[model samples]
Target chain A: MTFTLFDNEERMAGRAEAALRDLDFGSDEARAAYSELLDAYRKSLREQRRMMRLGDRLQEQLSTVNQELVRRRAEAERALQQLRDAQDSLIQAEKLASLGGLVAGIAHEINTPIGITVTAASILADQVAGLRRQFQAGTLARSDFEEFMTTADEASRLVLSNANRAVMLIQSFKQVAVDQTTADRRVFELKPYLSEVLTSLSPRLRRAGHRVVVECDEGLEVDGYPGALFQVLTNLVMNALQHAFEAGKTGTIRIRARLFDADTVELRFTDDGNGIAAADQGRIFDPFFTTKRGAGGSGLGLHIVFNLIVGTLNGSIAVQSQPGEGTTFIIGFPRVAPARPVAV
Target chain B: MNIHDISRAPTDRSPEIQFDPDACSLSISGASFPEDGAAFYGPVLSTLDEILKALDQRCVTVRIALNYFNSSSAKALMNLFLMLDDAAQAGNQVIVNWFHAADDDTMKEFGEEFAEDVRFVRFNVIPTAVTS
Candidate 1:
């Protein structure tokens, strides 16, 4: 079609139709057709510009609103997180204070058995020296030598028992401290660790007359902080001893270390004392929660134990305790080269 | 609104951040160490993986401005940088702009730690006004 639409002096092109699309106008016209079109078109453009201005203002307001919401939410979240952190820190601090209070008691409890063990060993050494001198004399007989050997064995037995007793006492405290304090890590042998820990706890065991059986893992290798694990074992063993054995009675504490996984070792400390109460089981890991609260007990023992195993050791601890039966603490830790170097 | 990126500030003790897929730029600013940093940042990196595919332009610049991250988060950030390196090496122009304040030595060291791992991409430690 050869239609020259732009030839006319109409500055507004197809103006009537444009307004209709913008706001739904009707066919009814009030003024001259061209004037109607122009006025409507201009008015529509003016309205659109006004609406755009309003929309922009609304968008700006919305942005400010959104930013305000975000800022408030962030502040609220930060405050909440800080609240949680403060609570956790307070718990840790409380645990530390209590541990400090009990440390002396633990040390004292451990020293007695150890001192006796040393004294017994010293006496035994003297007796062995006397027997040696007697044997050197020409009049000394084979029967006498045999009797001396037997007596020496008895003294050795006494020394060994006392030594172990002293060791257990120290170990309990060590375990409690190790769990509470974070330290550097290193590679260590398992058998020695088990013995050392048991030695430290021996005094407490003796006081309670709890016999501890050790089934050490042969050639076991560990690649984390030893002190932390030491603390964990100490707490578990002593916990078994003091709670498992009735006052004025005796009990048995069994410590078994074995390979749990390709790169993990599990230590199981079990005792035949009456098991953890069903009520106390759930609250055991919660800091400062303890049934033996009045007995100079720093209720942070298990909580510290759990933290050591899970936090410092990067492992797990499980307790299987039953009322009137016994309690067992099973801990598993990586036994090979750690993925990262531990701060030792 | 679609700013889908988060990072640990060089000196701040905060959490790690994730990038929004819809934004042209992603930023991570804060201290990171929420207990198990590996567990937290693991999924966030995975989330950024899907969003990176939707970008049509051949070039993507990801800025990492972290103040301080724990060892665990440090490992996670390494993994993340490696991921970006992979994407950048595979015909997608990826640029990693690591921003650090001039005074924060720790953040600078951390940024260099990742830069050491990256093979194909260019990593720049932009020293700006970083308040500790």
Candidate 2:
């Protein structure tokens, strides 16, 4: 018969007594042996009771430790979530700072064309007043009249052209700036939209003595977030202007776009400047990884570019560079992007 | 009477078992939580019984070092100690060394409890830096 020592003493004793009684023991020595066996069994029962008490206490201590571990894990998770929220706000601030820079750059660009237009209009008004006086006094010779006409013609032409240039600048700036700020999603012609982005960035390019060459086919269109694409292109151009060329040196930045497949379009941005070093190339897109940390690099330029193209635009980007040759960032994305999930 | 030696390998749920008839020594180590305690310990116990029966006032050593064991294994262990106690009563030298980790109070207490149950055999509950 199998019995745990946890069974009550009286029950166990009765079982042992019954077993001994059933056994054929013909001598007193055999009975004494049976009595010794009963004693061992009772001692084992007491041992089991003590072991049960010890096990219960151990189990209680283990439960407390497990609860402590669970609490620690939850605390770690909350800390991690806080870190993520802080990072997201920092990225937002960076985006707004870039947009502010764009606004300042466009304002500076519009000033020159508008200034020339105002100067030409004033000069035309002064010439008209001089011509009126001559006509009233009857001292208007054929040569004087002809000279006045010539001056008027030149001044009006200058005013018209300069005024139109100002209008064009404002138009392109408005489209690009609004798209970037609002993050609008729409179907847009790739060629004209790219030129508009380039126009908005022309002041920075001119100041840096760098030229951008755009080679995109006419009538090619993308059905995606134009604003996100604008941010991506702006960040890329800004990154090249900041790092690709040395100060006071000129470089050519080429942007070429074409249909990679029926569903995808590939855009390659190449710069003919000092290429990135081998060790720095891989970390360029990492946040806060910058060679110009103290001067002006927030290190989020390429990181923002990466997030925009990959996260917002649902695209892929890769870079190929040689230390002395140049750098090329090749980006490929679907012509029709998938819808983004609504953020909570 | 010939008593064969017993050697059983440890698994995820059971401890290793090694019995040497010539030396009259048995060592069980590692964790023991087998699904069926009787099935796992039946053959080993029978072999141990044979060895104890064949001994004539001979000495035997048993080493038990388990990190964790379930209720059923504990019961089997109790049975084993009872058999050793029977041999010691028959005028054979029996030494049982129970090894536990120094920090493991539960196992240490278990060893102490097992020692109290056996009146004849030398049950030594030893605390070590590690349990094997």
Candidate 3:
């Protein structure tokens, strides 16, 4: 283990000198042996220095690699964070796109009724103008007057009915559309609000032959973001329509709500349709998982629902279902939702 | 020798990467993002390595259509393109097609960036119609 016989070459040289002085220099054999030993010692020192240099170079290389890896890891983390943000914004965009589609459908629905009303009103105006001319020129007849009155009454009725229909459609659209676009908080009654949401979704419901009934206690009020609540309900209703019911099959969606506590509310949405299979029930909330791939399903419906409930409404959701027994989604949240919704 | 296809489904973060070894085609579509870009691309790089090694001077075609990809993914892609370049330099035929949506200036720029370092491989920045 004691590899170094001397601390330095000076000590080694002193030792060698003392040994030479004590040795018999007259013997050539001894002189030769001493010279060989000196050569071996010098070679060992040279080898040691070379080994030290190699070790230093290896350490430097390792440090460089470590630094490169650290930099790369940090870069990867930053990229991942950026990707997450991009994905989140895209999800938000999908939500807004859905709202846009709903608005377009509502507009189309309102247009037909309003168009008929306009035509009826114009016809009635023309009749009035003609009748006024007849009266002023002293050419008015009893039968003509009676016919005019009858036409006026019929036109008035048509105008009134259609105008009322348009007004109702617009009012419903205004309420639900406003909630979809804005995240502002307000105090509102629950039962009527649910009614408005269902009315706004009538176009989809009718198309799918699905009926949604809301059962909430009267005079129950909540101070929170109705927009978030609207989104949650919309997603759930849409999910049931898309997943729970078979195509062209009529299904009943029942939404029952009650106060869970003084500050909390429980809402249960049950659909009497083909329920989710036991295996798929677990991953229904996973993003981009759809049994209806290549169809109209985006697979973000339930995921968005989960996010809105937990993130926006600060609530929890659970699902109970069997293949033939139908599906029920039970959601519980505070009556007063968070002032500002958090991003999931 | 038959090379199996390498396909990964798209997630909220990352895009789908698919390689059809029999067709000598590899495609990347959707969002190119993952928490560990290198790890995600590691198998891709290795797969390319295997394909190139067995290519025997045959042509390999790479088609890339990524709507969005982060910087880390960009790096992984750069490495992949370099590997293709090396393969081409070794006398193997490599053709790389970089597709970007017409309205996506960012993706166009990325295609250009990847194209800059490629010489041996026939690299082309192709403009595609906006999908959504």
Candidate 4:
């Protein structure tokens, strides 16, 4: 085992042999020990590299799972937030609707008295002017005085009635405004509810220069708490009149309701004004979502309307609109009127 | 905002909630499951109470005709039903008819639940529709 390969390349071979001898491979035992040490060193180096690679892969997988978890959690939170926001908007819309109904009814109670008072006041003023003329012409007498007194009294009564009517409407409005039934339920009528709602919204609509034309099927009836519907309609109509038509411009709002198929009552409101945009259609019903930002638009109007129709009314409402065209809202109320209508 | 309450009519999604006063008659129909069920149905219950208290006869006919309502609204409906039932127990003939679709077993079950809470108020579950 001590042979040297220095016959051909004697110089290079002699250097290798010397180097190998310097490694101190003396006997079989010493050689085996050196080889064992070298093999252990190489194995440890390979193991460390393999461990590092495995650790890198494990960390990458953990990071991916964490990212997925964050994404899913964010999605869940978004959904929950949306639900909460929608619920809140729904409550607001229902409250507005109820108040509208009450106001409309109260307004009906006031109209007659106000109308009569206005007429009486006008007539009395005319009579007073006539009396003053007669007196100025030196033709006034005791009979004339008595007539004037009678006229004055009548005028005063008319004034009082008119004032009372105004007071009632105001009171009704106040009641509606301050109503805190974040939760309320009661049974009310259709006609009076609608009437009150319209009356409540009179000023708002009038201020917007929009006119409402109602065509209710005379005998059409259903059982629903009208306040929510009133709010829903008020918001929708006012939205069309005020926002869609632009302030100071006049538009026609048509409200038509009829019993359909004996099992559903359909109420359709169409406005001849600028309609909603196509892009805004899907998001119109989202809470706090609006195209009109910073114009005092809370973006809850349509959201409320949606809640009122779907939540309160337990009905379906759909919107059709085109920019620069007109918007139409169709509401389907399931069942109104008797299966057997009484022969009126 | 006074409570806006109505008894549904008899139908697939309706109840005949009626307030028949000597002065006027009030009826409610359609579905009322306000997102804020409590807010929507709250004033209605109170207003109804006021109206019923002021009426000549405590006996008012209420109909509820709702096609769909959420769980929160179901509570409100139950509250209304209980109120009517109480009025009936107090010597008033309060008739409550729970309406549903014949094919709608869920609604029928709902009607039955509402019917269980009555002593004197006549509770009737009527499925007027042939199919839900």
Candidate 5:
């Protein structure tokens, strides 16, 4: 038997015509059968055509919706990236502002020793001029000359000591200032480096009547980013001075460092001042969270500290405090810091 | 009856077709939305017609499991069922199983609608836990 394929309505119609021709039209039964078959085929064809139109429309709608979703996803991703970039720049600005504050404090601190040295040198110059006059008049007694010698000796000694003090102040200030500005990794004795950071912050500490005591092994060395460490210490000390002690009240901040393990070192910074409230402890490290919102608190200090430790140094920090008792920040990091990703 | 088996592999836009001569079973599964539905289903339909003509009181089983089908494929499916219905009317046992995912109400409705049109074939609309 030959198969005639019915691939479309025209082919089906042609096949129906052929079947009608093969049938005996004189027989009523044959006519009725052909009529029934034609009716069913026409009904099915109508329904199929209706469904075809509906399917075409549905496909068009689906494609349009899919395109819209793709465009919206791209737009949302771009917006998120922009928000992250803005956040990074804000963090950088906050860090620079804190460094600027330290610079001002150190400048004021160096003024005292430098001023004393200048005053002593002026006194010595006046004494030498008087001695020259006395010797030229031919009326200088041995007793006067000996007394002048003693005064000259004391004045010279005062100038030498005060100048040396000024030099020492500048040296420490220079070290801390450079470290804070340039984020370079190096090996340094932890005790002396902490001392240098504290020295740079000495003027603010003295003004607030706060004393910082550092305790660490004399030979305890750390290979890490000193600039990040400087930022962390500066932020913690400033945070304490700002929120801890009341005006004109004296306080002490102690920083103790020890080896937690062969590979890790821990530093505990504790201040004997007002402690954080229990409710505020959880949000203290969050950006723009502060009890002193309008009272000269940018609130980014602790947030910056947290980011530097966790992100840059790959370290961990935790705070413990009780109201009216004190607050202690426990920081732990590797002895040799992990390699940081190169900046893009 | 020396009827050859028909087998068609599934594409991204079309369903798989399998016909077993020994078991007297035909199964079509997967999504069917071919660009040229008539061209795709024409050969299968001709082969089914030949198999039905060669049968002598043989029980033929047809199973369809579709996730989606365009209108052209739907038309082709209607023709296939009609042929099965004709065979059942001529004293042959024909069983048609329409399987749909339990969650797909549209496919279930399509099965019911198709069953209403066919009179002789034993049409069973089955709800399956998994969709093919």
Candidate 6:
């Protein structure tokens, strides 16, 4: 409002002197008021400059902080991606390890029959050698020959039957093992596939004195990955065997399957054994949270089951259990599972 | 009498186990995933036992280089390391060298775990470049 007061100090002082010489102020009081106005205007200008400097400093600090935050966010994202990759690889490794255990089980099963065959074959070989020596010496008797023939026949039968059994076991195992290792989607009948998985698990079941009674409707076909289904079923059955029952405790597992609707199917797995505690039921699906630590429990079985059902199959599962009572798992999945599985 | 050297070829399911008493060294390499883990590692364990018994405080090095192994094989490895630890405690210099791929964090972590379990044995975990 007063341009003279805003001029440089030398110019303002000259203007004040000129005004006084020209008698511009009407009285002494008026001159004093003009001087005071100049002082206030100079003070206000100083304060404005100081505020501008402060604003610049604050802006610089904010920019530095923003840059640091962006860098940290990028680093955190990289770390998170690395963690995801590690988790994926570990899950796959666990699956391979489970398959390795299955292979070991089948091998042990086959070894038994092979051992019997080896013993029987050796006995037959010895009897034939004796017969050859007796015939060569021209001292072979009819009773001796008859006895040797009987022994050979019995040994042959034993060898053949046991060898045949081993072959059958291998064949059945081959199908289940192949299905387990591969994840290619294919249409398959539900009931028979369930039976195959159960049969493959027979050795574990028998060892634990557990009986599985499957009640599936006939001709219930599903369009999905049998391999995934096999893994899901295997995990459920093994979980029950490991966690549900106590040592030397005979338990019965009932598996029932039916069509939930046109596009979905429902499967119920129940066991009459020790149930999970209420506190632990929620965290049961968490990876590596096992109550049986140091007792040969990997604690990944149920986690893997959960991943397969929800992540791979695009399905849902629920568990209902109470302490001292039986535990039941209900799973619902689309008849035709998703074409591509969701990566973890 | 000294323990004889053992040389086993690698199979699809098991690793190659080579133990040379003359060299005072044993090396197991490749994927150690056997159908019958106990049966597969049984002879190796027994041979090591015999060598340790006859070692007479001689320094022995164990080289374990596995790309993959199952849980059961992990148990077997634990037992093997324990045996070596015992031998070391008995005044035998036992050195265990665990080799893992540079990018294999899980195997490296496993090596670290095994190292924690053995006190007397000189545990060395070395990361090497991954071969094609």
Give each model a TM-score.
0.41, 0.60, 0.55, 0.48, 0.61, 0.58
**How much does each candidate deviate at the interface, measured as C-alpha RMSD after superposition?**
27.4, 5.9, 20.2, 40.6, 4.6, 40.1
Q: Considering only chain B, what TM-score does candidate 4 achieve?
A: 0.76
* Residue B100 alpha-carbon offset, candidate 3, angstroms: 56
| A1-344 per-residue lDDT for model 3 (tens digits) | 22221224546666886777687767788788887787787787667555644554555566579889999999999999997887678687779877886886787788878998989999999999999999999999999999998998999999999999999888878887788888777889999988888777777888877787889988889887788788888888888877888887899999998898999989999999999999998899887777897877877888888888888888999999999879999999889876667866
Q: Is the docking of candidate 5 incorrect, acceptable, medium or high quality?
A: incorrect
DockQ values of all predictions: 0.01, 0.05, 0.01, 0.00, 0.14, 0.00
Looking at model 6, residue A183 earns an lDDT score of: 73
| lDDT (tens digit, per residue) of candidate 1 on A1-344 | 22221212133445544544464334445334655767776676567445644554555566579889999999999999997787578656755664563565577666677787778788878877877787677667778778877877887898888887666655655654663465656677788777766665565577667688999878887877877776677667656655777788788888899998788888888888889988888889886677887885656677878887887777888888889998888888777645664331
CAPRI grade, predicted model 1? incorrect
Per-residue lDDT for B1-132 in model 3, tens only? 234545788897688877777677788888765665656776667666777866767778888988876655665677788778888888878889999899989888888978888889999999998768
Q: What C-alpha lDDT values do all the predictions have?
A: 0.68, 0.86, 0.81, 0.66, 0.85, 0.83
Q: In angstroms, how far off is A256's CA in candidate 6?
A: 2.4
Residue A64, candidate 4: Cα error in Å is 8.8
Worst 10 residues of 2 chain A by lDDT: A1-10
Report the Cα RMSD per candidate.
Answer: 21.3, 16.1, 24.7, 33.0, 9.9, 33.6
lDDT per residue, candidate 4, B41-129, as tens digits?
56556677666555454556655556666555565666667667667666766776677767878888898878886677788788866
For residues A1-344, could you state the per-residue lDDT of candidate 2 as single tens digits? Answer: 44343334557689889978887788889899999989997887678666855664565566579889999999999999998887788788899899888988888989998888888889889988998999999988899889988988998998899889988988888888778877568899999999999888888999988989999977899998888888999999989888889999999999999999999989999999899999998999998889998888988889998888888788889999998788999999999988871231
Candidate 4 structure lDDT:
0.66
Q: Who wins the DockQ comparison?
A: 5
Please identify which of the two predictions, 4 or 6, would achieve the higher lDDT against the true structure: 6
Query: Candidate 1 residues B38-106, lDDT tens each?
Result: 356655666565656555556767777666555555555665677677777676777889888899887
lDDT of 2 at A78: 99
Quick one: ranking by lDDT, best first? Answer: 2, 5, 6, 3, 1, 4
Candidate 5 accuracy as lDDT:
0.85
The top-ranked prediction according to TM-score is: 5
Cα deviation of A1, candidate 4, in Å = 35
